[model samples]
Target: MYIEPSYIFLVVPAILLTMYAQSKVNTTFNKYLRVASISGYTGAEAARAILHSAGIYDVQVEMIPGQLTDHYDPRSKTLRLSSTVYNSHSIAAIGVAAHEVGHAIQHNKGYMFLTIRNTIVPVVNIGSQMAMPLIVLGLIFSSFLVNLGILLFSGIVLFQLITLPVEFNASRRAISILENEGFLAANEIGPAKKVLSAAALTYVASAAVAIANLLHLITVFGGRRDD
Candidate 1:
């Protein structure tokens, strides 16, 4: 029931690191958006071309209202882009659109990691929301509950681990597609890669922080139960 100073100290650095990583990603993405122009096609047009070239006719590219909210929905078979990406002619926009299309390509080609990530999506979603509460409750109540919390929290961590590959692979696919399909010039490649790489790091930071916090939690609570 008592808060551990050690755990607090450990989490403080993780919180700061994650925030800094997120800020860098946003700053880099915006910087590239301003400097690197998309040669001709808009992000939506480029995404469609990429999808059509891959013989993916069923996927739809639609504009949504937001900043950097682009994503591919496997369930709906839709590639959703924020207004900036959907309308802008910028390297960052194309890069992000291509990244989402990369997910569609993965789905079509049956990428193993992507498939596994999709399969665990619902379980991870529910587990993430419930894990901390269950762990705290278990700490206050019973050893059995605490162990159950550990198992559940472990699932969340596993999901974060699985997500790393899925995200990295998508960025790799985006870069490859941009190069092969002539969406970006040689100079544009640098900025595009930087944007995608920055975005990917945010995921890495999230996973790292999650695992660290979970370990801190277990170290404190589990040690208390032993005594």
Candidate 2:
């Protein structure tokens, strides 16, 4: 297989940014994880309180194992918090909990971006799985396959792009809820913001990587149609 120099040029920087984003989130989370919030609300309590404040009593808050694995399941209407965030009263924990709750709030409010993201998730999953194999086979066989594969892979890139505003909005909502609800002290809010901001960087890096990969594919295989 011939490697394109453009692949390295286009993709390597995004990969490096991804590595940096992961490191930053981990480091920032850990740093804030040790700083207990003055509110003294465990992550679970903080999440529940915020949900109740928003009149979202139907959503269940539950604990799950792992670090940085917290998420909101809109279908189940459940917010699953990781062990790190579920039990800890640290500023990082509360911020993360609030962020996941923000997603629940979005679901409740019918946020347009979140709705679009959820609707396309199934299509994106199929596209992501089939894209690479189609692209590779196209290289060996038909131009039609190449074009089809690129189209499928383009969905993945589109999904990533759509995800950015969703994540950013959640983080912003988390900050606002945390401040308004007094989940964190005036001094502690800054540290919580740092944690959420670091996490948001990871999402930005992911979108960058997806865009870079899409560009690489277009540059390398886009013109392979049979003449």
Candidate 3:
């Protein structure tokens, strides 16, 4: 019963949620990407302005390649923005840039959740990389290894759960900063909110996927303990 087909059944909900989240994010971003902010600032300028306004000077903003591939590297204290976001003056671009900067700001502020998430990065990385192999080998060889693999994989689930708040808070901070600083007009905030909200749902969907995977392991492997 602990086969790929069984696992598929278990993860179907998460897979569906992930698909919906992706579609929503794409639709929202495309809809808002055409609308320019009244301030006429590019995404890089908006990110720089937000960082300066927050009294955060250490985090450097750099243009990175690819679409919607923006992220903040806390270890390097750098904010990497995709070309579309770094150069475009679209409201969606600014909103996304601002959201990434919010992560830099979080780093500066020593946000507790962010701190915890960063602390576990190494473990999660290793776990994600090794979990499948270890789990398969355990299934073929020893029950102990199966439990070990399952335990390691749970780190990924925990990481995803912690990430939900980190992402949501960053988006919230981004909009608040944009609105309060007059970077986004009153009417402009709606589209920005929609984009951020859609993006946040992706994180939720990711967590769901992780949880589903974890549950499938427990359902399948947990039975091995009795045998």
Candidate 4:
């Protein structure tokens, strides 16, 4: 297998930015870790409350192990939060939990971007896993496989790009609900915003990294002129 120094140049900046985004999330979360909501609701309770307010009773709130493993599963109709978020009453925990609930709400409402993302998931997974091996084999054997591999990588990048808007909209909904419903008090909004915004930056950084990797691959291998 061939590696390109250009790959480092392309991917390093995105890696650095992703690290920065992760740091920001840790800082913001730690800053608000002790700060509880005025309503004194744990993150799991907050999710339930927000879902009820949104008239979404069908979604189940459940706990799983690990840190920041929170996510909403559309198929299972379940919202799973990390142990920290599931039981903690901290602003950071509540913010994260609410964000996942926003995803549940999106699924319930047939959110367009989410619908698109979900529809493409199986293909994207297959494409992403297939890209590198196909590219490597194409380099060694069949030129026809090269362009196909690049296209597969591009699909992954497209999926990441679509993910950005979905995540931003979820954060928007979470913040709006927290603020409007008084789960976040006037003075506490900044920390919650910082936490969610920091988390959003991580997604942005992930998309950026995917794009950077795709560009680097294209630059190195995309110039083949014959099959």
- Candidate 3 clash pair list: none
In terms of TM-score, how similar is model 4 to the real structure? 0.95
Model 3 Cα shift for residue 139 (angstroms)? 1.5
Instruction: Give per-residue CA lDDT, model 1, range 16-115, as digits (tens).
Output: 8789889988998889777646477788999999999989999999999988888999999999999988988889999999999999999999999989
TM-score, every prediction: 0.93, 0.97, 0.95, 0.95
Candidate 4 C-alpha lDDT tens digits along 1-227: 86687787889989999999999887888778778778788999999999999999999999999887899999999999999899999999999989999999999999999999999999899997999999999898877788789999999999999999999999999999998989888887788888989999999999999999989988988867554
Give the TM-score (vs. native) of candidate 3. 0.95
Winner of 3 and 4 under lDDT: 3
Candidate 3, lDDT over the whole model: 0.92
- Looking at model 4, residue 131 earns an lDDT score of 92
RMSD of each candidate relative to the true structure: 2.1, 1.1, 1.8, 1.7
**TM match of model 1 to true structure:** 0.93
Best-to-worst order by lDDT is 2, 3, 4, 1
Off by over 4 Å in 4: 1-5
The candidate scoring highest on lDDT is 2
The list of candidate 3 runs beyond 4 A from truth reads 1-9
Name the lDDT of candidate 4.
0.91
Looking at model 3, which ten-residue stretch has the lowest summed lDDT? Answer: 218-227
